[model samples]
Target: MVISNKSNRRHFIKKAALAVGSALLLGGSLLPASVMAELGEPEKEELKFGFIKLTDMAPLAIAYEKGYFEDEGLYVTLEAQANWKVLLDGVIDGQLDGAHMLAGQPLAATIGFGTKAHIVTPLSMDLNGNGITVSNEIWEKMKAHVPMGEDGKPVHPIKADYLKPVVEEYKKEGKPFNMGMVFPVSTHNYELRYWLAAGGIHPGYYAPAKGDITGQIDADALLSVTPPPQMPATLEAGTIYGYCVGEPWNQQAVFKGIGVPVITDYEIWKDNPEKVFGMTKEFTETYPNTTVRVVKAMLRAAKWLDENDNANRMEAVKILSKSQYVGADADVIANSMTGTFEYEKGDKREVPDFNVFFRYFATYPYYSDAVWYLSQMRRWGQIAEPKSDDWYMETAKSVYRPDIYQKAAEALIEEGTLSADEFPDFATETGFRAPQSEFIDEVTFDGTKPNEYLEKFSIGLKGEEVIK
Candidate 1:
């Protein structure tokens, strides 16, 4: 939980590098000793950042609490914003220099979906830290339909299809089933949709051109926006039957005995990227070294969080339990954290990548990751028409900046703040991951083949189609 000093940044790199036994990975060219000694100073040291009450906000919390910000000669104040939009607004209006953001927020905004701004991310926060939860009534009804264990606990990573019959029942009874997620462009929205669609349920669409942004057109389950902290209260009051959101709110429901969490996004799409650290393109340009310094600190914090194979997560959960950060009780936070994610009241299972920080290059802003989000945007009709493959690639490159990430990574390596082996082979790295087939639907997603990937999905609008 400690953000090492700048001098110590170098020290930890050597220690971590040696510990990993990959010290010789950096074969000389990337960071010469001359460049290593040229650690740039922060241009604007004092700053404000914002976050929601989710556990994935831990990197920012870790950075601040551990003095990673100070280690870069930057003084920072971390504030919890009222909601996603407000937090995004703060960043857009210059009230916040940067903030922990929904991975889709910057992408959506950049593409003119909600509040249009040219926001971009140099740091992806963490991977697969969200889930969908249902009330006790829904869980009770959903259990019988779901495949169960020999021990009879309803073998999980439960599909929304289990809930689909229930939703159909509601429809047959002339009733509506509703769910809440944090935002239209949120990972929760896509995960919920993906989960539902994978189970042969139509989660609905967005016909923005028709002046319908509700996204419930031709829907079985109606999904709407509810802020993260409000998820527990809203579900408790029966305002929503179920919700898709991040921690510790899902655990908050279990603490309140109001609901059961059915599935985590890690279970939906393993190691799916979540929130990221975002600022305007102008902000990074106005202060390049400061931006890299910020990423360096965050990278260190991310590495510490994932180091020891998450041996430090228990202590991190304790830190996040503080009133200023997530503000949820320690036990509540620990439910889905600490390598065990819970479903129902007592069904906690070991899911180690539930909140990956630095391992597997989790923080790297890959163009493939950006393209996937854009594909979801297209699937959901956020983008009105069919865009060329080049459009997808170009848009991803514009928003997810691996070039900037490389500069930051290089600086850290040269300064000995991180070893060359700590990152991918920069020379051979293609900012795109190989086509992946880990989704709940078993649909292959090749970032290079977006349209073809979309064509494989049975639920989403693929190719040139539109929801009328």
Candidate 2:
């Protein structure tokens, strides 16, 4: 009889496997010599990973589809979580093995921001896959203030300064100028705030200590959380005038002609770190072999993504379009993935470095990147209290584990799967990048000194400052 019961089916399969094994032994056991000598077998072979429906989640999908995970002797199930919090909680609660998480999630968690947990990341996912987009109406109001080029197209990197007048006009009408970001601790929130504050617009603050997490105190424009996929619809409903989100949603807005993408995060801050591969610190420590193998698989996938000048991006787009993956249309995902980003409806431009995955040592989880995110949190009051430079360094080291990343890269190099030249030189590698000054406002940020970095911003909380 055919067994419809799952338990019975499993039992039958187990018995069948044992019988087959016994026969094989009776028939003079034949097994190939082992090849997994350098790196031991994964402590846990089956894993369930979670991700949101954004394009930057490509590393997980690519690793699964390209057989990189299996090549590492791991059976991974990639599930799409409802949102960021859900995805994070899944990892914390042991429902998920790991996830494609925000760069700030692990840091914020370890520092007791939203959900208190010891989350850590060994890999930085793709970089520069996010953009700031505005509703067509907002664009129309702001376009008049934007300078035009010889082709009559609005000049590139259309600064939020142009939108300041539109915000003021809304203020004059007693209407709240509302905008959306993925999460409060998200890079999107900080990027949106940075662009707005750079334009002399107050994007507001988070008074978490005072129980005012609305992030709208003393605000010129009110910013709130909206899931990435809902951003375009929220704009259509007039709930928000603009949003900063990761791809294909921003590109989706351009394709649907409902909104205009104003600036990519690449323009806001060149090669900025975006998503990351996150797991609970306990999980990594308990399953060290599995964690290393997981990072190794993802590292190979990331390299494949940016390989040969993104020659594999089109195939990557197809995989991401599958219903089990990003589930966006191939064209919408391709709009940004293929090295060109459509800003205004017809203003498609070449932004080859728009979605970097492996080039420029982008895969390394630099403590400096973590420090930059923490500095923004303090600048905007998410941190609530002043912290010393050493505190910032310690917090960054706790969350962004480059030691784990280095181990994975070394294993990949030893296996001949990747070359040592493709990765950062582990011998002399420092976790910090040289001070970066390419912000929209040209503000130089020294990750080694976060409090001093906060003092550079005029619109944010500096040293010893707390929300009143």
Best by TM-score: 2
Name the 10 consecutive residues with the lowest summed lDDT in model 2: 1-10
Model 2 error, position 284 (Å): 0.6
Model 1 ranges with Cα > 4 A deviation: 1-33, 36-39
What's the lDDT for all of these models? Answer: 0.86, 0.89
Q: Ten-residue segment with the worst summed lDDT in candidate 1?
A: 1-10
lDDT of 1 by residue, 376-453 (tens): 999988887889999999899889987778887887787677888889888999999988888777788899989988
Which of the numbered candidates is closest to the native, going by highest lDDT? 2
| Model 2 TM-score, 2 decimals | 0.93
Please provide TM-scores, in order, for all candidate models, with all chains considered together: 0.92, 0.93
